[model samples]
Target: MFKLFLLTSLLFLLPIFHCYSLPEPCSGTCVNAHDPSIVIRPNGTYFRFSTGGKIAIHTAPDLRGPWTYKGAALPNGSKINLKGNQDLWAPDVSLVDNLYHLFYSVSTFGSQASAIGLARSPSMDAGTWTDLGAAGISSDATKRYNAIDPNLIYVNGTYHMSFGSFWDGIFQVEMNSPPTTAKSNVQPTQIVHNSAESAMEGPALFRYGEYYYLFFSKGQCCGLDRSRPAAGKEYRIMVCRSGVSTGGFVDKSGRACTNGGGTVVLESHGWVYGPGGQGVFQDPVHGPVVYYHYVDTRVGYADGQKRFGWNKLDFTTGWPAV
Candidate 1:
């Protein structure tokens, strides 16, 4: 026939031109599975929020997902009066003007008194959750900064939040409503100030073209010490960019995240150690993807513990670098 129907229509348009073209690097199941937060709902469905603190809703009428698991929108196991000791850590979701706001984090391990919490789900649809309590707080360890990883950005209408970890880096605040009730003197600024080698935490924000990306992840995460793979520098997953979301923020060899810059994006080739707690979304059609958590080192723990390992992210030049 006409040259086998033009080689089967160029092999189905060559995977739609390799799914929207980018710098490329993520080769198969995109890390197979870890911390991936790709949300695309307006009636399209594709939600992913992680850290085991809960929030994983994957529904796909499209966006190429055989994906269909709509469970755990976070009401799970419950316990949060504060003093730090609840399981849910690092869960981020954002949607204002139409409701659905879920930002989570509450800690107690190497404590900086961590706390960042809020929940609501009018339309990510599954259970229609609601738990608006303690949207921000970092308990005062003399107060430099260390309020777990929470990310939400609205821009002109104001939602702005970028949390912290390790007591002295990555902070930003602004929220009046959309579920969050109070906090808007405009005061929590310090964009990025990590060092010591690398101890920065996860903070993700995005806005391409004019540039406003601020994806974060830094060294030393979880470890079981099955010898040495997941125990050294904490973790990896670095990236910096800023036309101005409140930063000079450069990396991708440009350097200058205050003085650290960070550019690796995603590390650990074989065993998968500290991949870092990260977040980035867009799945209306698989547009931009990144979700984090890693340390599968081999997966041992019963006290043999080496918890949390999840993945998916790839950007490469505009520089998500993972």
Candidate 2:
């Protein structure tokens, strides 16, 4: 009887040990360092960029951090900040032609005024940042639309960016300059449009096998109580796959993403509400991990304060199954 009681107690305590063994006081080291942009350098270092108007460097000999923060990857206050600027939002980083290019969003939050700018860093080390200047700007709120969430991808010797916020859904632009050059004629084209079910934003693009996967977040972000059952709204990470980079993106149901084809890749369960601003990276060892943020619906937390989290990515059937 005594041995059986001990075993039973151990079983109950096992769950507590497992849960508590994870990290605590979720911060930059956790995940979703705001709007995370992750990249791996040739030397096997992983760097992350966030939307706090600053880029953070996470260096590890391995894919996983026990990852350390070096500092901002770009010079402070490099934005033009012309009309109703809201610091920096989502940043996309990539290396091309032996140089590093950082594309980021400058927008006015609730307002439509927004722009996408470019910066360069010779190396991933701290303080090697340089201001390359604005790559493109929207003409006005309506026609020009909100220019945000910039992601760069090189395909067949052509540099392409997936970006947009309000008005049209996610937009794509081609870079005329070499992947390294910050100055380019980014001609905007509508690739994805909004739907009635949700408003889509924060697009991250990646290609695996023969399919081009566009990973995006939809619905309200921030607000800790936003995902409460009675809240009547949800923020989720959704995905669509296409044969072409420009995309005829469709969901598992074969519905176009322009018509709300986004199938939930990650979502709020319990108190974990994700207005998924995310980045996908090919880890040298772990394969690929989706780094993103979510609202920790855990009790006794302040409003608008969300926690960051990361999970090993699973790609089955050409979709990013997180």
Per-residue lDDT tens digits of candidate 1, residues 1-322? Answer: 9999999989987743212222223321222233445556776655655545355555655434455566667645334576544466667777776777877778766777667878777686657877666775555577788777777787766667878876567887776756374374567777777676637777888877778878777765554353343344656667788887766888778777767677666666555555667666654444566656555545541212332333335554576544
Error of 1 at 60 (Å): 2.8
Worst 10 residues of 1 by lDDT: 17-26
- Residue 40 local lDDT, model 2: 77
What is the TM-score of candidate 2?
Answer: 0.82
In angstroms, the error of model 2 at 92 is 0.7
TM-scores for all candidates? 0.30, 0.82
RMSD of 2: 7.5
Per-residue lDDT of candidate 2, residues 101-198 (tens digit): 87776666566666677777778577876766577655455564467788888888787777776566887777775754323545677766665643
* Model 2: lowest-lDDT 10 consecutive positions: 16-25
